[model samples]
Target chain A: MTPVPDPSEEWRRLDRRTVLVTAAVLTGVAGGAGLPTVLGLAGAMPLWRAVTWVLAGAALLVGGGAAADYVRWRRTRYRVGAERAELRTGLLLVKRRSLARERIRSVDLTAHPLLRVLGLVKVRIGTGENAGGESTLELDPVTKAEGERLRRELLDRVRPDAPDSPHDGALAVLDPGWIRYAPASFVAPLLGGAAAGAVMQVSEWFGAQGEVIEWIGDRFQDTSVLGMIVVLVLLALLAGTVGALGLWVEMWWNYRLEREPGGTLRVRRGLFTARSISIEERRLRGVELVEPLGVRMCRAARVDAVATGLVKDDEDKHADHKTLLPPAPRDLADRVAAQVLRESEAPTGAPLTAHPRAARTRRLRWALGSALAPVAVLAVLGAALTPVLLYAAAGCALVLVPLAVLLALDAYRNLGHGITGDYLVTRSGTVRRTTVALQRGGVIGWTVKQSSFQRRAGVLTLTATTAAGEGAYDIHDAGEGEGLAFAAEAVPDLLAPFLKPTGVRDAGVETRKTRG
Target chain B: MTGENAIRDEVRLRPPRNAVDERAVTWWRTQLLLTTTVPVVVLGVLGALLQPARFWLLLTAGAVAVAGLAATAFFPAWWFRVHRWEVTEDAVYVRTGAFWQEWRIAPMSRIQTVDTVRGPLEQFFRLSTVTVTTASSKGAIRIEGLDHQLAADLAERLTRITQDTPGDAT
Candidate 1:
């Protein structure tokens, strides 16, 4: 593939991080170097006396600068040459090393407010170990579009262009709700910060009111702890409301993801130093289609993919960001689910993998959740000893009522895993009911587990592994041979067009099924 | 289909360990107790010999020695016995829980790296270990008691898979 320079390159220089950091350094130097002459002309304090503080401050600034420049020089530049990506760095003791690009695994990018202001971001490329694993390179202050551009360059040098890019119209258009990941991210953090602030304010306010109470004590008793608690609770409700509203306002910024013409997802966000990341459909490892308990009842779900690389555009700030499918209308979960799971290719072929709602797994989650009942019962029993214990037991029961119901319901909803063509997908979650997907070729391995009783029931839970950890993409329950069947039946022999740099396997699936 | 077959093919670890060095430091309590108590036992033994007026001093050293020895011997044994792994064709399986019983596996395709390690104890026992790391979480799966050649071969095989796996997004 003859390399095509990125169409987005012009926008790269538009970042402010490069400008700000450079400007800040220049400004500090100008002020420090120019100060002596300026003070000398004014003849302030004895020139000798003035020279001491001015010289001292100047030395501190420039001396401090030598270290700063070295650190910046170290983390700032990374060049991926023809065969290798060499990362050279260090402020004092400079170092340089290059990993074969073919050995490169995943590249991560994160952009924060400061980086956004500077119009720059950070990018990290992880090549598993030594010359291969965990060889990391960070590029700071790259333009907003540069990360994707670098990824594109790396992709071109490594493989042919991705086959199923969004331009092919193979992927369904998704509507991203800032509410999905953002609510928990933005709202929870906001409320938590506000709550701490509120506590401090309440204490100060009450302390100030104490003087008034001292005079009014003859007419009315001092506000009791109960009264103070009640007031604090009311304040908490007020704070939560205000915090939520503020977060909603912050949510209005550009947090959109466009499905590019090349069957790839391009997600861009951040109000100032806008960050954009590209996720190829082929790199979809596993989907964490979360239907959080609250969202489940509301019939909504947030589908997040266990994508291969981090968005390099934002890493100057958010160094570790997962490029994902934004939340869409719940009804659309099924619509776009197949493409996200690698089941839909315009070319003719059976979808290789499976979905969670497969036959045997329908009851798998229920069995596992019900198994927790004994432990919960034991704890409940252990709490019922004295009068205070009885009240505590009652309180715990109230909490368990919702916990058990939610778990059981969520389990029942999540119960299913079966082939969805060459793409293996599992759909589960209470709030954001999800449909997770992964290409057979994208599968790293398979896991089978059976509890003692499950062994008795003749059932084993199977999870299809992908590069994405914790969120194994698919879990199925089937007859013993079903595991091997998944590997033999689905895993792709040919790599998908634009397979993830390090995620796709060139070998047969390994079925690691067993009872623990 | 039988439990015996499952035992032989026990899916001991989850596919692709999320972290490198994924094993929990379960022996930390035992290690902590032994390191702290052993020196105290030595001090007590010396003190008892120097000042024999307190006959019970010898009993104190015996008690510490008993706890330290029990922890040291049983701890490493339990750690090794409970932690087991099997890299089947599809996934690297691990079964690591001592009591509650949890099984995990990482796919060969998902494995980021496979490492072979021969710890001081394993070398003495003529055994080797294979450590598997994945792109997922920081957790890793280490399978001990394999022959040295087998461990090296498995690591080579795993690295090959990781290298060839083709998610183009990297």
Candidate 2:
């Protein structure tokens, strides 16, 4: 028999420099963790003794981490075979997992600052299944060139006869002027709140809480309590603005949206950490125009792609892989959205059919109920316990009632739905109004819901079930006949077989049927 | 006149044509009995052992048991009347829930997988639950309490039909 070539020879090891990267990372981690430990220990014991203990612990931690990573690197072997990309990892358990080559949908490349310096990138091969980590193959710290090659090899299924579209190249790029919109976002207030909390927490950590409080009290001693509070709030807001600006830059620096040759839209961004996220144009169902309250006031909107298989990883829940463009001018957003979907005009910008008046009444009721709930609670407590709470309750109602009513009216006004060629569009929400244009063809199912109360009101909610995006987008509180008709028209035969044309019957029967 | 005309032409979603196997009512009763009474009984025993003098806790447990028993007696039959499933050549239709009613329709062309699941109780009752999954996360239609053999055949048939159909089912 001919000598059988070793099967293990075909298996490739992870980069040898992974050990170095691991060591460096471990050192950084040790330093970060050791400082706090040393500080805490220094108070309990002598400073030099604490320092020496921490240094020894840090060395041990780094050594242990590097050794573990070295063992992991030695054990981990991956092979991109003819049919499957297989990875065999773990020491004792020896977990062997494989993903079919054809099923692979994305090959993202990311490089943090350290990885960038080392000329290495992490390659994440995903099947785009919502099935957690099982469907992903992660090769950490692969050479940048290797990552690029792997990405190309996996995603190189371009149709030979694909027509060259006019908008095939760079679709959009970062504009420095966009930073002006950063502070206008809700992030500013959130960051400001976080900054205030952090200041208190950090001062407490350093045992300087009392001193900081005294200093603040001294600074504001000249002013009245109200004026002091106002100044402090303004200062916090200024700090928040700066923080939000920095965060925005770090997140969206060098942002570029490009439509590649093989019908893929690639988004490349980040400053210290580079990310290359690719979305196959075929998987794109539609686009959403998101206008948050503050952003809306500034006449700007963000465009997000509605694509299948863009599930967030369990480990990286905050990673938003759907956004194609940040908050920009509304007209520019519409234009970019149109270009992204390859339509003459953005479907999201199309005039929508306004929801019925009863829908508005329902929202008003809900808003009034919500606004009244806390006041009612306070009033009850005041009657039972203290009279001061009654005054508080009244004050709250004065401020909250009109605000709730305004919001209710805005929400009611925002409710709309319509069909625009191949896309069925729906818009809703007030604080964060979202206009979704979903591909009519992408809808695979429909769910129609009607509560007993809704039956009385002659309204229903129609949910278009799609494989893409949030899976289901609702047309809420529409006239029963109108909603059903819309569903029937949106997807031809899906809902037709279930519907029966009948003369208006007794409402009692319908309610009883629902209850039963 | 046009508004009235639109209302006149409107169609309402009727319940799906088929009801599940009748055994589902008994199966649901048994399941609910186990789920509800187990906790109440455990709490009653623990209360009696730990604090024999605290009579109100035992009374509370007794009240919960009575409520659970009432629900076990009536809810299943009501649910049996409401829950429905019908598979056509084009789509799978289902109507489910009691107070907040819902009608779901999933097209065959978009169906991703079909499975027959038999839990311990279902197996004991010789029943099966046929789960029809579409690409959409919200579009998994479960037809509970079908005859085991019938569910298997349905699952097999669906698998064959879906295999013949093209596209990524997205």
Task: State residue B121's C-alpha deviation in candidate 1, in Å.
Answer: 3.1
lDDT per residue as tens, model 1, A238-264: 676567545544432465544544445
Please give, for residues B54-160, the per-residue lDDT of candidate 2 as tens digits. 58768878888888899999889989999998888888898888888888889989999998999999999999999999999888888888889889988998888
Q: Over the stretch A343-368, how does candidate 2's per-residue lDDT look in tens digits?
A: 88888898887777778989999999
What are the chain B TM-scores of all models? 0.59, 0.92
Q: Go through the candidates in order and give each one's DockQ.
A: 0.16, 0.47
Interface Cα RMSD, each model: 13.0, 6.7
What's the CA error at residue A238 for candidate 2, in Å? Answer: 2.4
lDDT of 1: 0.52
For model 2, the superposed segments whose C-alpha errors exceed 4 Å read: A1-13, A224-226, A311-319, A504-516, B4-9, B33-36, B39-55
